[model samples]
Target: MAQDDKAARGPSVAEGAALVDLLLQMADDDLVLGHRHSEWLGVAPDIEEDVAFSSIAQDEVGHAALYYELASQLGAGDADRLAFDRPVGERRSAAFVELENGDWARTAMRHFLYDAFEEVRLDACTRSGWQPLQRAATKVRREEFYHRLHSRTQLHHLAKAGGEAFARLEHALADLWPYVASLFDLGPHAAELRATGVLPADAAALRSAWEAVVVPELSELGFGVPACGGTDATSAAHRGAHHPALAELLTTMRAVLDVDAAAASW
Candidate 1:
């Protein structure tokens, strides 16, 4: 069959599970981080940033909805339920996103790092053999350009300011670096996804692509760029495990829905 025809028909039963796994991973990452970003609404360092982070948070949640919708079509259940109702252990978001947003510097550092990784991941998804994912990724990538710009610009300004600003950012990077590899862990069906071209690149290739973009930029900013691969045992557990923070986050995130279970259906 032609490539387009294959994509239009969707993945075979054998590939369906892997495709759903990939979709949930993408969706959960955005959803969890978006919630974290939203926490800055009234409290960001400045009014301008408050608005910027709010807008960025909206975009990330919207992107998550897009991915969740795709997963729902593939029989993952309602998008809202998939996002809000999943148990902590069932969530596929990386540990990096699940961590509480520490401080302004930590938030900025996480934003820059996650956006850099997202750029790489989404770029690869744009070329995926799955046409639906390719199209959705293309849409998300357009909006992500501004996100990357905002994060990079923030990092540059903070780095150039020196003194405590630079020190804080450096500290944030060190604290966050170990969890970075978890973002590239692609879940259990990674090999199948790569073989079927559902994901155009495997985790290692994606990580390398991410490093090429970030490592030099970070070095130029005078930050010590750490080695790129290898997750700690906790982070290496992929989607099967999560930090304790995620459980707390979910309770708060689902607070309203928990009260009104019917809200999720709407």
Candidate 2:
């Protein structure tokens, strides 16, 4: 198909709503988690990982902006305002992204878990019949290749090291699993998304696929994940709820935008 032809296929109003719903969930996840990862700029285990993580943060934020631009085309809002000006309750990020970045182990574990889910989601999006998403997913999935490797390498080394390092990694896994599993929550437009082929599957199907990949990988790393990830109720809570940490992060993130005059360019 020609690129121009693909770009010309705009969604109907109802389909646009589904598209917007998916876009907001993805944009919020990337935007919020990008900020969380940015918190580790100077605090990762070493300068190498710090720089690597900073790049990952930048990639995530770029992905967020891409998605927000797609939303803006659908009449959501400008990317800058959509990302920075939204009320806390209006964002649809999975609850896990809202968690505070802890020590090295916790941060790496969160990255591994999140990157795993993100890889799967990008794969699904690549299969979306929607042209804009198809292009974005293809591009983002290429970048995620390095992210997946970087995160998995960190988790593997820590888990295999044994002693305090191994113990800390195991503890991080145990502590983060509940929140991390919520990444698959698809928010309120699952049916429309699936029906329109904007998403390849419903939340439960994607959650199962995520577990199929992540569970055995964790088991191989020698930590038994105690819970079965998120239930329907938990998924709803994860998609709908905001953690206290998000508010704090937003306050700092929106500072420049909030204080400046409306027409000021930065």
Number of the top candidate by TM-score?
1
Top lDDT prediction, candidate number? 1
Error of 2 at 152 (Å): 0.8
- Model 2 residue pairs with clashes: none
TM-score per candidate: 0.95, 0.93
lDDT of 1 by residue, 59-134 (tens): 9999999999999999889898898889887899988898889999999999999999999999999989899999
Lowest-lDDT window of 10 residues in candidate 2?
Answer: 229-238
Off by over 4 Å in 2: 1-8, 229-232
Candidate 2 lDDT (Cα, 0 to 1): 0.84
lDDT of 2 by residue, 39-136 (tens): 88887778987898899999999999999999998999898989988888888888788888777888888898889899888889998878889999
Clashes of 2: 0
lDDT per prediction? 0.90, 0.84
